[model samples]
Target: MRRQKKTILLASPRGFCAGVERAIEIVERALQKFGPPVYVRHEIVHNKFVVNELAKKGAIFVDELDEVPKGATVIFSAHGVSKSIKEQAKIQNMFAIDATCPLVTKVHNEASRHHRKGRHTLLIGHAGHPEVEGTMGQVPEGTMTLIETLSDARNFNPPISDGLAFATQTTLSVDDTSEIISILQHRFPEITGPSGEDICYATTNRQNAVKKLAAKTEYFIIVGADNSSNSKRLVEVALKFGAKNAVLIPDANSLKLNELRNVSVVSISSGASVPDILIDEVLKKLDQEFDISIKIESSIKEDVYFNLPPILRTR
Candidate 1:
């Protein structure tokens, strides 16, 4: 039987942002430099495949510092960690390597600066996310509040609204964040924000590319892990923008090509935490099952690069 023809719109800027890359490498290098049984405070980047690969390389992912033996080397996830975590590591005499993405660190710094100047910070992000928790933990309790929705924005009545500022998770929906920001600004004219966008460049670029293809693609497949915020957001963006059906598959191996038989066009993308090999796998699978025509849908070329931590810089 002749295979059916399908169009594949591949989204660029879709996989392994610099931060994730650096984080994963930090573990690898730490293993090489310090040797494993190296402790990681969290799944390095929320991708099962990545985590498993690292685990195979002797990286031990732990939920907290207590799980680690004192004086052992520990690497923080790219999502960043609370100041308290660092303090705890110090008290434990552990050799800690901070793998927090520099962009996330920027948000932490902004939040801390706001608190220092006595400006209450309205943190725009989902609660319970590691990044949100870490950001919230940046300052003393009550110095910052989590604003997860427009409702949160409208309902927020700070003890004193005049001295206020805002910051956001590095991974978030740009449109959604903007709406929240606009609402907060309307309610509190004095609310300040980051000089640049709080959402990282890779996230914004990936989302923008997906937005362009969503209206045209009938079936959208985002290859990413379940816990990845940016990956899940892509699914939401696709459905919101116009894709008829969208799904988040942890990896290409999890995809169901049978369901795509009736679909003529598919947009394939992955989370920043994912590797492009996963996206390639989806393309390979589709190619084997159908006559697929693939088009690269890219609005921006990402030239940005984040250097690894100072110790890793020499080599």
Candidate 2:
């Protein structure tokens, strides 16, 4: 029987944003400099593959500061931690290295500035996400309110209307966040916001690439961890942009042949935290099942790069 022909459209700028790259590098460098059993406050990034790889290199993942022995080294996750966590690290006397992405750090700084200026801040993000939790912790408990949906934005009534400001999780859906921001602006005309859009450039570019690919592909697959916000957003963006079917898979191993049996034309992309090696795995798997033709669709060229922490610079 003649094998069926399938076209796989791959989105460019699909995996490992500059921030994720920097975070992983920090962990690897820390392991080399400080020796094994270097404690990490959380998963350096959201991907299981990434965490597992780092673990093999002598990194220890812990949920809280209490887990670390006094005088040991600790590194914070790419999702920035709150003020309290910083204070705790200092008190514990742990040699702490911040692996938080520079972009997320920017949002944290904005939140702190807003609080200092007495602005009743509103954060547009999903509840319980590490990034959201970390950002919220930047200010006093009651100072920042979380606005997760359009309904939340509509019903929100600030105690002091004139002193309102807003900041958002760096990985949120650009389109969805815009709607919430729009609603907030409508309700509170005096509300202040960050000088620029909080969504990172890599996120916006990846989403834009997926949006274009979704229009032409019959089915879409987003390769990323379930907990990763940007990866999940790409799945949503694909479905919203017109793909017939879209799903989030952790890696190439997660794909079911049955799902792609009817999908003649498919598009594949990975979340920001994903490594390109996973994307290659998926492509290899697809090639085995069908006579595949590959096309690379790049929406934009990303030239952004972030440097490692200052402590690692001299190493």
- Cα lDDT tens digits for candidate 2, 1-315: 777889999999799999999999999999999898999998899999999999999999999999999989999999989989989999999899999999999999999999899998999999999999999999999999999999999999897757999999888899999998988888887889975559999899999999998888898999999999999999999999999999999988989878888779999999999988899999999989888999999889989999898899876
lDDT of 2 at 185: 85
Q: Candidate 1, 200: how far from true, in Å?
A: 0.7
RMSD of each: 1.1, 0.9
Model 2: how far is 114 from its true place, Å? Answer: 0.7
In Å, residue 150's CA in model 2 sits off its true spot by 0.2
Error of 1 at 85 (Å): 0.5
Q: Which ten residues in a row have the lowest lDDT in candidate 2?
A: 188-197
Global lDDT of each candidate? 0.90, 0.92
Q: Which segments of candidate 2 are over 4 A away from where they belong?
A: none
| Clashing residue pairs for model 2 | none
